[model samples]
Target: MPPTPIRASLLLAALLLTSPAWSADPVHKEKVELTAEAPTHSVKGKIKGYGTAEYTLTGKAGQTLRVQLKTNQPSNYFNLRQAGKDEALFIGSSGGNSYQAKLPADGEYTVQVYLMRNAARRNAAASYSLDIGLRN
Candidate 1:
């Protein structure tokens, strides 16, 4: 039996909604650089709609890593994850903006800035400053 036009449209919408990765948001990536004289690096950016910004840095296992975010949008948050890992070490929305912890491994780490789904869907814009610090 041929499906009705309404059914086809509804099915397409459902697929699109369910497959967020298939229609994933764009990500802007940057490397964090800190010289020997400075242990901290600060970066500023703006994210609109569903876009995200990713910052990558390297650290040792025993070093303490600190990340602080200041943003005008309440829904804007950051997540910290080790490269090649699926789980997040920190989720800023639930854990708050300031994070300090000892590194779990010696490798590359990523800090991702984004808005919550609700705010993202509304095409909201957020301006933020992120500070990354590393210490022994």
Candidate 2:
């Protein structure tokens, strides 16, 4: 049976409401910029509730990458992932707030800062400083 226009609209709305990504918080993305003479950059920002901040930086394989996060909220943490990938190379909640590693591939990497579910549910806000560095 062919569905009516109203029925199709209702179905679409339902699908959208039930989609896994629908409830996910919108991400704030920014490209990490560094001065030509400095290998490090510092960014300070604030986030509330389920908000997320993603910092993307490009690097070459074998280059060293360093990231340090300081936040007021204890539950706030960060994750490091390669571009277009869901799995994290480093999960700050489990690994602590500092991450230093040699790049495995030549591409963009994202450092995502977010609050844990418990804190986010309480509408927690965090002010954070993220220091990122890339060097040989």
Candidate 3:
């Protein structure tokens, strides 16, 4: 059955309000670069088949970063892991839709967005905005 007009309107409104960080399909989660010209990065996508959508932020040692995610679905959380490492550094998860940290080295850092305690059901559509930037 088709969604009602009011319901469709609300859905459209939500999608329109979401920032354009949602990446196209086949997102490369490890190739994010933040520059002086473009100091923030945002990606929007979904989690299918229990896998996470990955993103990377590059910065120098001692740089403070605040990364946040805004989502339209439930059970969406992100993990922050150091680059080239398998385990999440400091065992940290976003706890909700936000992550913050001070980088320990000058290199790449990984931010992984996932669903429901590390598992995503099939065809579950999740839209999210990732905001990564330096702390003021």
Candidate 4:
């Protein structure tokens, strides 16, 4: 069957986005040396403007992942993302300071520390401490 115009456009856009020519950044840019069973439980960084501290953690499907963020400023928060994925797996920004989720895939995942939306929009810099725990 012939593809619809919108479907063809969407496919073309997806291909262009994933093409090696695009040169996209990895979701976990910091690349922490993390193991599934022995996860790194602590990290700290400062985020300014659109900058985020992305930490990579390796884990198996069904493992429980716990993340917590703390900062003197109320605008700092954290989020979780699977490697290569564009959307967040778990978001802690709108709620409090922590998030825990049962992982859905086996791979290197990201723990992103970022400022709140308004803070980020203002290009403010905030210091933060994050703790990540993974358990099968």
Candidate 5:
């Protein structure tokens, strides 16, 4: 017996229908570090500038994400939020130089850090450092 063209087509169709789709969903994990310097002091020995740092992370659907932030100064503030969201999921201030948070679902996210005080307020100086990471 010989296989017909129609039969071959049917067999191919069945195999494709039963096979699992292999979409390339890559898992990504990485870390970023940033540093910013405060503006120089004025004639009266008053510092007058602030610094900021930001990081962006991407993930697959249902993947878990972890983020960590660190600063050299004590008065720095850290925040995490979805890429386009206006509100932050986590925030910390006046704590140890290190902070961490986890993402609820897959997508893009951002981490932001800024100085806690204005230099003019009390002639204080502000600087920031940050570290960020993501995992499946």
Candidate 6:
């Protein structure tokens, strides 16, 4: 027997509803590196502006992520964010630049660098580099 219009529609709808057309958030476990240059020094040899660097990270819903950073100069700082919340992950002065943190959840996150405006007297420029890594 031929199916009625309503019956055919119902069958099609049921088939589509039961089909697998959904996916969960992807788990990303990787490392990202970033770098920035310091602003030019003032005539009196004072650092004027702060340089910045940024990175985005993604991971599973409940996976732990680690971030590491290293710099060449002093008075440098870093900030980490996950799920839109920001935190000052690291701050250093006159030493090697390195920092680490754990991921909040399975989503996109960002890390930023800020060069402290009071590093030295002469306005000089310097190159800065950052290294980031992740783990399960």
Best by lDDT: 1
Let me know the TM-score candidate 4 reaches against the reference structure. Answer: 0.68
TM-score per candidate = 0.80, 0.80, 0.66, 0.68, 0.48, 0.48
Q: Judged by TM-score relative to the true structure, which candidate is superior, 2 or 4?
A: 2
- Tens-place lDDT per residue, model 3, 1-136, is 9999999999999998886744433344567877778778777776664557788767788888888788887677778777777777643343566667678778878787777753454546577788878642
Per-prediction count of colliding residue pairs? 0, 0, 5, 0, 0, 11
Give the per-residue Cα lDDT of candidate 4 at 119.
Answer: 83
The residue-by-residue lDDT of candidate 2 on 3-90, one tens digit each, is: 9999999999998778587567768899986544888989999988999999998988999999999999999999999977778999
Query: How far does residue 75 in candidate 1 sit from its true spot (Å)?
Result: 0.3
State the lDDT at 114 in candidate 5.
Answer: 55
**Candidate 1: stretches off by over 4 Å:** 1-24
| lDDT, candidates in the order shown | 0.93, 0.91, 0.71, 0.76, 0.49, 0.48
Off by over 4 Å in 5: 1-48, 94-101, 118-129
How do the residues 25-77 of candidate 4 rate in per-residue lDDT, one tens digit apiece?
Answer: 22325666556665756766777766678888788899888888889768877
Span of ten consecutive residues with least summed lDDT in model 4: 21-30
Q: In candidate 4, which residue pairs get closer than 3 Å at backbone N, Cα or C atoms, i.e. clash?
A: none
| Stretches of model 3 off by over 4 angstroms after superposition | 1-30, 90-94, 117-119
Between prediction 1 and prediction 6, the one with superior TM-score is: 1
lDDT of 6 at 31: 32
Query: lDDT by residue for model 6 over 1-136, one digit each (tens)?
Result: 9999999999999987784634322222233432224211111111124435555655555444444444455565556656555544344433235544455466766655555666523433445555555555
Tell me the spans in candidate 6 whose CA falls farther than 4 Å from its real position. Answer: 1-48, 86-97, 120-124
